[model samples]
Target: MSSKRDLIIQAAKQTFLKQGFEATSMDELALVANVARRTIYNQFDSKEELFNAVIIDIWKNVKPYRPEQNDEAQHNPSKGLFNLGMAIANYWSPPIVRSFLKLVIVEGDRFPDLPRNFYRLGKEPMIQSIFDYLTQMKHSHLLKIDDIGLATQQFIGMINEPLIGLGLIILSDEPDMQRKEHVVQAAVQCFINGYQP
Candidate 1:
Protein backbone atom coordinates (compact mmCIF):
# COMPACT_ATOMS: atom_id res chain seq x y z
CA MET A 1 0.00 0.00 0.00
CA SER A 2 1.39 3.36 -1.05
CA SER A 3 0.96 6.51 1.00
CA LYS A 4 -0.78 9.52 -0.55
CA ARG A 5 2.55 11.30 -0.82
CA ASP A 6 4.13 8.31 -2.56
CA LEU A 7 1.23 8.08 -4.96
CA ILE A 8 1.51 11.75 -5.80
CA ILE A 9 5.26 11.50 -6.29
CA GLN A 10 4.94 8.47 -8.53
CA ALA A 11 2.26 10.13 -10.60
CA ALA A 12 4.26 13.33 -10.91
CA LYS A 13 7.40 11.44 -11.91
CA GLN A 14 5.61 9.67 -14.72
CA THR A 15 4.03 12.89 -15.91
CA PHE A 16 7.30 14.80 -15.75
CA LEU A 17 9.20 12.07 -17.54
CA LYS A 18 6.66 12.01 -20.33
CA GLN A 19 5.72 15.68 -20.63
CA GLY A 20 8.67 17.46 -18.99
CA PHE A 21 8.52 20.01 -16.14
CA GLU A 22 7.53 23.04 -18.18
CA ALA A 23 4.66 21.24 -19.88
CA THR A 24 3.22 19.30 -16.90
CA SER A 25 0.48 20.95 -14.90
CA MET A 26 -0.78 20.52 -11.35
CA ASP A 27 -4.28 19.73 -12.68
CA GLU A 28 -2.90 16.95 -14.86
CA LEU A 29 -0.94 15.61 -11.92
CA ALA A 30 -4.06 15.70 -9.78
CA LEU A 31 -6.03 13.85 -12.46
CA VAL A 32 -3.31 11.23 -12.87
CA ALA A 33 -2.80 10.83 -9.13
CA ASN A 34 -6.58 10.63 -8.59
CA VAL A 35 -6.15 13.12 -5.78
CA ALA A 36 -7.61 16.56 -5.36
CA ARG A 37 -5.43 19.45 -6.49
CA ARG A 38 -5.44 20.77 -2.95
CA THR A 39 -4.07 17.48 -1.71
CA ILE A 40 -0.91 18.09 -3.67
CA TYR A 41 -0.67 21.61 -2.28
CA ASN A 42 -1.15 20.22 1.21
CA GLN A 43 1.92 18.04 0.71
CA PHE A 44 3.96 20.39 -1.47
CA ASP A 45 3.73 24.16 -1.36
CA SER A 46 4.12 24.54 -5.11
CA LYS A 47 4.84 22.74 -8.37
CA GLU A 48 8.57 23.40 -7.96
CA GLU A 49 8.47 21.72 -4.58
CA LEU A 50 6.66 18.75 -6.11
CA PHE A 51 9.19 18.57 -8.93
CA ASN A 52 12.07 18.73 -6.45
CA ALA A 53 10.48 15.87 -4.54
CA VAL A 54 10.20 13.88 -7.75
CA ILE A 55 13.87 14.46 -8.55
CA ILE A 56 14.88 13.44 -5.04
CA ASP A 57 12.66 10.38 -5.30
CA ILE A 58 14.26 9.38 -8.57
CA TRP A 59 17.76 9.89 -7.14
CA LYS A 60 16.84 7.80 -4.13
CA ASN A 61 15.56 5.03 -6.35
CA VAL A 62 18.76 4.82 -8.34
CA LYS A 63 20.92 2.08 -6.80
CA PRO A 64 23.69 3.69 -4.78
CA TYR A 65 27.22 2.30 -4.81
CA ARG A 66 28.00 0.94 -1.38
CA PRO A 67 31.56 -0.34 -1.65
CA GLU A 68 31.53 -1.53 1.95
CA GLN A 69 28.83 -4.02 1.00
CA ASN A 70 31.07 -5.67 -1.58
CA ASP A 71 33.96 -7.52 0.03
CA GLU A 72 35.49 -8.48 -3.33
CA ALA A 73 35.84 -4.81 -4.23
CA GLN A 74 37.63 -4.24 -0.94
CA HIS A 75 40.36 -6.74 -1.88
CA ASN A 76 40.73 -6.06 -5.58
CA PRO A 77 41.40 -2.46 -6.62
CA SER A 78 41.36 -3.10 -10.38
CA LYS A 79 38.08 -4.96 -10.24
CA GLY A 80 36.75 -2.31 -7.88
CA LEU A 81 37.58 0.50 -10.27
CA PHE A 82 35.95 -1.36 -13.15
CA ASN A 83 32.84 -1.96 -11.06
CA LEU A 84 32.69 1.72 -10.10
CA GLY A 85 32.81 2.78 -13.72
CA MET A 86 30.17 0.24 -14.70
CA ALA A 87 27.91 1.32 -11.84
CA ILE A 88 27.98 4.93 -13.00
CA ALA A 89 27.32 3.92 -16.61
CA ASN A 90 24.45 1.69 -15.57
CA TYR A 91 22.94 4.41 -13.39
CA TRP A 92 22.90 6.91 -16.24
CA SER A 93 21.77 4.38 -18.86
CA PRO A 94 18.22 4.18 -17.54
CA PRO A 95 15.56 5.80 -19.72
CA ILE A 96 13.95 7.65 -16.84
CA VAL A 97 17.28 9.13 -15.76
CA ARG A 98 18.10 10.08 -19.30
CA SER A 99 14.71 11.75 -19.64
CA PHE A 100 15.26 13.71 -16.43
CA LEU A 101 18.71 14.74 -17.65
CA LYS A 102 17.26 15.92 -20.95
CA LEU A 103 14.60 17.90 -19.13
CA VAL A 104 17.20 19.49 -16.86
CA ILE A 105 19.37 20.44 -19.80
CA VAL A 106 16.44 21.91 -21.70
CA GLU A 107 14.85 23.80 -18.82
CA GLY A 108 17.84 24.59 -16.59
CA ASP A 109 17.48 28.35 -17.07
CA ARG A 110 13.81 28.32 -16.10
CA PHE A 111 14.43 26.37 -12.90
CA PRO A 112 18.00 27.19 -12.01
CA ASP A 113 18.04 24.98 -8.97
CA LEU A 114 16.97 21.84 -10.79
CA PRO A 115 20.38 20.91 -12.15
CA ARG A 116 22.18 21.89 -8.96
CA ASN A 117 19.80 19.89 -6.81
CA PHE A 118 20.02 16.92 -9.13
CA TYR A 119 23.83 17.01 -9.08
CA ARG A 120 24.00 17.45 -5.34
CA LEU A 121 21.61 14.55 -4.74
CA GLY A 122 22.49 12.27 -7.61
CA LYS A 123 26.02 12.82 -8.93
CA GLU A 124 27.90 14.01 -5.85
CA PRO A 125 27.32 10.81 -3.90
CA MET A 126 28.51 8.65 -6.76
CA ILE A 127 31.66 10.70 -7.08
CA GLN A 128 32.18 10.46 -3.36
CA SER A 129 31.86 6.68 -3.51
CA ILE A 130 34.49 6.49 -6.23
CA PHE A 131 36.70 8.91 -4.37
CA ASP A 132 36.44 6.76 -1.25
CA TYR A 133 37.44 3.70 -3.24
CA LEU A 134 40.38 5.52 -4.78
CA THR A 135 41.46 6.68 -1.34
CA GLN A 136 41.40 3.08 -0.14
CA MET A 137 43.44 1.97 -3.14
CA LYS A 138 45.99 4.70 -2.47
CA HIS A 139 46.24 3.76 1.20
CA SER A 140 46.88 0.14 0.23
CA HIS A 141 49.73 1.32 -2.05
CA LEU A 142 47.96 -0.21 -5.05
CA LEU A 143 48.19 3.21 -6.75
CA LYS A 144 50.31 6.25 -6.13
CA ILE A 145 47.99 9.21 -6.47
CA ASP A 146 48.89 12.65 -5.21
CA ASP A 147 45.36 13.82 -5.90
CA ILE A 148 42.72 11.10 -5.71
CA GLY A 149 39.91 13.57 -6.30
CA LEU A 150 41.29 14.70 -9.65
CA ALA A 151 41.86 11.11 -10.68
CA THR A 152 38.32 10.21 -9.72
CA GLN A 153 36.97 13.03 -11.87
CA GLN A 154 39.19 12.10 -14.80
CA PHE A 155 38.26 8.43 -14.63
CA ILE A 156 34.56 9.31 -14.51
CA GLY A 157 34.89 11.64 -17.48
CA MET A 158 36.65 8.96 -19.51
CA ILE A 159 33.88 6.41 -18.95
CA ASN A 160 30.99 8.88 -19.04
CA GLU A 161 31.85 10.83 -22.19
CA PRO A 162 31.75 7.94 -24.65
CA LEU A 163 28.57 6.38 -23.30
CA ILE A 164 26.74 9.60 -22.42
CA GLY A 165 27.84 11.66 -25.39
CA LEU A 166 27.23 9.02 -28.02
CA GLY A 167 24.65 6.71 -26.53
CA LEU A 168 22.49 9.20 -24.67
CA ILE A 169 22.97 12.74 -25.93
CA ILE A 170 23.55 12.01 -29.61
CA LEU A 171 20.89 9.28 -29.66
CA SER A 172 23.33 6.70 -30.88
CA ASP A 173 22.50 3.02 -30.63
CA GLU A 174 22.60 1.42 -27.21
CA PRO A 175 26.06 0.19 -26.33
CA ASP A 176 26.24 -3.58 -26.30
CA MET A 177 27.98 -5.63 -23.60
CA GLN A 178 31.19 -5.76 -25.64
CA ARG A 179 31.27 -2.01 -25.97
CA LYS A 180 30.61 -1.52 -22.25
CA GLU A 181 33.27 -4.00 -21.28
CA HIS A 182 35.80 -2.36 -23.57
CA VAL A 183 35.02 1.05 -22.18
CA VAL A 184 35.21 -0.03 -18.55
CA GLN A 185 38.38 -1.98 -19.11
CA ALA A 186 39.96 0.89 -20.99
CA ALA A 187 39.06 3.32 -18.23
CA VAL A 188 40.50 1.07 -15.53
CA GLN A 189 43.65 0.42 -17.53
CA CYS A 190 44.14 4.12 -18.20
CA PHE A 191 43.62 4.99 -14.55
CA ILE A 192 46.06 2.31 -13.50
CA ASN A 193 48.67 3.39 -16.03
CA GLY A 194 48.52 6.93 -14.74
CA TYR A 195 48.53 6.13 -11.03
CA GLN A 196 49.95 2.66 -10.53
CA PRO A 197 53.33 2.52 -8.80
Candidate 2:
Protein backbone atom coordinates (compact mmCIF):
# COMPACT_ATOMS: atom_id res chain seq x y z
CA MET A 1 0.00 0.00 0.00
CA SER A 2 1.28 3.45 -0.88
CA SER A 3 1.14 6.41 1.43
CA LYS A 4 -0.94 9.38 0.33
CA ARG A 5 2.22 11.39 -0.25
CA ASP A 6 3.80 8.67 -2.38
CA LEU A 7 0.67 8.20 -4.40
CA ILE A 8 0.44 11.91 -5.06
CA ILE A 9 4.11 12.08 -6.06
CA GLN A 10 3.75 9.18 -8.50
CA ALA A 11 0.65 10.68 -10.05
CA ALA A 12 2.31 14.07 -10.29
CA LYS A 13 5.31 12.58 -12.11
CA GLN A 14 3.08 10.90 -14.66
CA THR A 15 0.97 14.00 -15.12
CA PHE A 16 3.97 16.31 -15.42
CA LEU A 17 5.71 13.94 -17.75
CA LYS A 18 2.68 13.76 -19.99
CA GLN A 19 1.51 17.39 -19.89
CA GLY A 20 4.67 19.17 -18.68
CA PHE A 21 5.03 21.42 -15.63
CA GLU A 22 3.68 24.63 -17.11
CA ALA A 23 0.43 23.00 -18.27
CA THR A 24 -0.27 20.64 -15.37
CA SER A 25 -2.75 21.93 -12.80
CA MET A 26 -3.39 21.05 -9.16
CA ASP A 27 -6.93 19.95 -10.02
CA GLU A 28 -5.62 17.57 -12.66
CA LEU A 29 -3.10 16.22 -10.20
CA ALA A 30 -5.81 15.60 -7.60
CA LEU A 31 -7.96 13.78 -10.12
CA VAL A 32 -5.07 11.61 -11.33
CA ALA A 33 -3.87 10.94 -7.80
CA ASN A 34 -7.42 10.08 -6.66
CA VAL A 35 -6.96 12.45 -3.74
CA ALA A 36 -8.83 15.53 -2.69
CA ARG A 37 -7.43 18.96 -3.58
CA ARG A 38 -6.77 19.57 0.12
CA THR A 39 -4.81 16.36 0.39
CA ILE A 40 -2.52 17.55 -2.38
CA TYR A 41 -1.99 20.91 -0.67
CA ASN A 42 -1.44 19.20 2.69
CA GLN A 43 1.49 17.34 1.16
CA PHE A 44 2.83 20.06 -1.14
CA ASP A 45 2.39 23.73 -0.42
CA SER A 46 2.28 24.70 -4.09
CA LYS A 47 2.65 23.37 -7.61
CA GLU A 48 6.25 24.57 -7.74
CA GLU A 49 6.96 22.72 -4.52
CA LEU A 50 5.42 19.58 -5.94
CA PHE A 51 7.45 19.93 -9.15
CA ASN A 52 10.65 20.26 -7.16
CA ALA A 53 9.68 17.15 -5.24
CA VAL A 54 9.23 15.35 -8.56
CA ILE A 55 12.75 16.31 -9.65
CA ILE A 56 14.15 15.12 -6.31
CA ASP A 57 12.22 11.88 -6.63
CA ILE A 58 13.65 11.25 -10.09
CA TRP A 59 17.17 11.98 -8.90
CA LYS A 60 16.69 9.56 -6.01
CA ASN A 61 15.92 6.79 -8.48
CA VAL A 62 19.28 7.18 -10.24
CA LYS A 63 21.90 5.12 -8.45
CA PRO A 64 24.72 6.94 -6.74
CA TYR A 65 28.25 5.65 -6.31
CA ARG A 66 28.84 3.37 -3.34
CA PRO A 67 32.09 3.88 -1.44
CA GLU A 68 32.00 0.26 -0.26
CA GLN A 69 32.53 -0.86 -3.87
CA ASN A 70 35.71 1.16 -4.24
CA ASP A 71 38.29 -1.38 -3.14
CA GLU A 72 38.33 -3.48 -6.30
CA ALA A 73 38.27 -0.48 -8.60
CA GLN A 74 41.12 1.20 -6.69
CA HIS A 75 43.47 -1.64 -7.58
CA ASN A 76 42.81 -1.31 -11.33
CA PRO A 77 42.55 2.18 -12.77
CA SER A 78 41.25 1.10 -16.18
CA LYS A 79 38.56 -1.06 -14.65
CA GLY A 80 37.66 1.65 -12.18
CA LEU A 81 37.38 4.31 -14.86
CA PHE A 82 35.41 2.10 -17.26
CA ASN A 83 32.98 1.30 -14.46
CA LEU A 84 32.67 4.98 -13.59
CA GLY A 85 32.04 6.01 -17.19
CA MET A 86 29.45 3.30 -17.59
CA ALA A 87 27.70 4.40 -14.41
CA ILE A 88 27.52 7.98 -15.71
CA ALA A 89 26.26 6.86 -19.09
CA ASN A 90 23.65 4.62 -17.50
CA TYR A 91 22.43 7.42 -15.25
CA TRP A 92 22.02 9.93 -18.06
CA SER A 93 20.50 7.57 -20.63
CA PRO A 94 17.23 6.80 -18.89
CA PRO A 95 13.99 7.86 -20.67
CA ILE A 96 12.61 9.44 -17.52
CA VAL A 97 15.79 11.47 -17.15
CA ARG A 98 15.56 12.53 -20.77
CA SER A 99 11.96 13.62 -20.24
CA PHE A 100 12.91 15.54 -17.12
CA LEU A 101 15.76 17.24 -18.94
CA LYS A 102 13.46 18.26 -21.78
CA LEU A 103 11.02 19.63 -19.21
CA VAL A 104 13.78 21.59 -17.54
CA ILE A 105 14.93 23.07 -20.83
CA VAL A 106 11.38 23.96 -21.80
CA GLU A 107 10.34 25.40 -18.43
CA GLY A 108 13.62 26.84 -17.19
CA ASP A 109 12.87 30.38 -18.32
CA ARG A 110 9.51 30.49 -16.59
CA PHE A 111 10.90 28.98 -13.40
CA PRO A 112 14.44 30.28 -13.10
CA ASP A 113 15.24 27.91 -10.26
CA LEU A 114 14.20 24.77 -12.12
CA PRO A 115 17.42 24.18 -14.08
CA ARG A 116 19.65 25.09 -11.17
CA ASN A 117 17.71 22.90 -8.78
CA PHE A 118 17.82 19.99 -11.19
CA TYR A 119 21.56 20.35 -11.62
CA ARG A 120 22.13 20.58 -7.88
CA LEU A 121 19.88 17.61 -7.26
CA GLY A 122 21.14 15.39 -10.06
CA LYS A 123 24.35 16.34 -11.91
CA GLU A 124 26.24 18.06 -9.09
CA PRO A 125 26.35 15.07 -6.77
CA MET A 126 27.33 12.73 -9.58
CA ILE A 127 30.17 15.07 -10.58
CA GLN A 128 31.36 15.26 -6.96
CA SER A 129 31.31 11.48 -6.71
CA ILE A 130 33.47 11.18 -9.83
CA PHE A 131 35.80 13.89 -8.52
CA ASP A 132 36.19 12.04 -5.25
CA TYR A 133 36.84 8.80 -7.09
CA LEU A 134 39.54 10.48 -9.17
CA THR A 135 41.07 11.88 -6.00
CA GLN A 136 41.13 8.42 -4.49
CA MET A 137 42.72 7.02 -7.63
CA LYS A 138 45.43 9.69 -7.38
CA HIS A 139 46.09 8.98 -3.70
CA SER A 140 46.35 5.27 -4.41
CA HIS A 141 49.08 6.03 -7.01
CA LEU A 142 46.89 4.38 -9.63
CA LEU A 143 46.92 7.47 -11.84
CA LYS A 144 48.64 10.86 -11.94
CA ILE A 145 46.17 13.65 -12.61
CA ASP A 146 47.40 17.24 -12.58
CA ASP A 147 43.94 18.77 -12.09
CA ILE A 148 41.20 16.56 -10.75
CA GLY A 149 38.43 19.00 -11.66
CA LEU A 150 39.41 19.47 -15.31
CA ALA A 151 40.05 15.77 -15.72
CA THR A 152 36.66 15.00 -14.22
CA GLN A 153 34.96 17.47 -16.58
CA GLN A 154 36.75 16.11 -19.61
CA PHE A 155 35.92 12.51 -18.77
CA ILE A 156 32.28 13.37 -18.21
CA GLY A 157 32.15 15.45 -21.37
CA MET A 158 33.48 12.55 -23.35
CA ILE A 159 30.77 10.29 -21.99
CA ASN A 160 28.04 12.92 -22.39
CA GLU A 161 28.95 14.37 -25.77
CA PRO A 162 27.74 11.52 -27.88
CA LEU A 163 24.97 10.26 -25.60
CA ILE A 164 23.40 13.66 -24.95
CA GLY A 165 24.93 16.17 -27.31
CA LEU A 166 24.25 13.96 -30.28
CA GLY A 167 21.92 11.10 -29.46
CA LEU A 168 19.33 12.66 -27.16
CA ILE A 169 19.03 15.92 -29.05
CA ILE A 170 18.68 14.31 -32.45
CA LEU A 171 17.19 10.87 -32.05
CA SER A 172 13.72 9.90 -30.88
CA ASP A 173 14.81 6.52 -29.56
CA GLU A 174 16.97 5.63 -26.55
CA PRO A 175 20.63 6.24 -27.18
CA ASP A 176 22.28 3.10 -28.43
CA MET A 177 23.96 1.03 -25.74
CA GLN A 178 26.76 -0.19 -28.01
CA ARG A 179 27.62 3.42 -28.85
CA LYS A 180 27.52 4.37 -25.18
CA GLU A 181 29.81 1.47 -24.26
CA HIS A 182 32.20 2.32 -27.06
CA VAL A 183 32.42 5.93 -25.95
CA VAL A 184 32.89 4.99 -22.31
CA GLN A 185 35.51 2.38 -23.06
CA ALA A 186 37.38 4.70 -25.36
CA ALA A 187 37.24 7.52 -22.83
CA VAL A 188 38.52 5.25 -20.08
CA GLN A 189 41.37 4.01 -22.27
CA CYS A 190 42.29 7.55 -23.28
CA PHE A 191 42.14 8.74 -19.70
CA ILE A 192 44.33 5.88 -18.52
CA ASN A 193 46.85 6.54 -21.25
CA GLY A 194 47.03 10.24 -20.40
CA TYR A 195 47.34 9.66 -16.66
CA GLN A 196 49.72 6.69 -16.71
CA PRO A 197 52.84 7.06 -14.56
**Clashing residue pairs in candidate 1 (N, C-alpha, C atoms within 3 angstroms):** none
TM-scores for every candidate against the unseen true structure: 0.87, 0.88
- CA lDDT, candidate 1, residue 20: 81
* Candidate 1 error regions (>4 Å): 171-173
Q: Write down the RMSD of candidate 1 (Cα, Å).
A: 2.1
| RMSD, one per candidate, in order | 2.1, 2.1
The candidate scoring highest on TM-score is 2
Q: List the residue pairs that clash in candidate 2.
A: none
lDDT of 2 by residue, 5-97 (tens): 999999999999899888999999999999999999999999989988988888887876654387777688787788879888888766788
Query: Candidate 2: worst 10 consecutive residues by lDDT?
Result: 166-175
Question: What is candidate 1's local distance difference test score?
Answer: 0.85
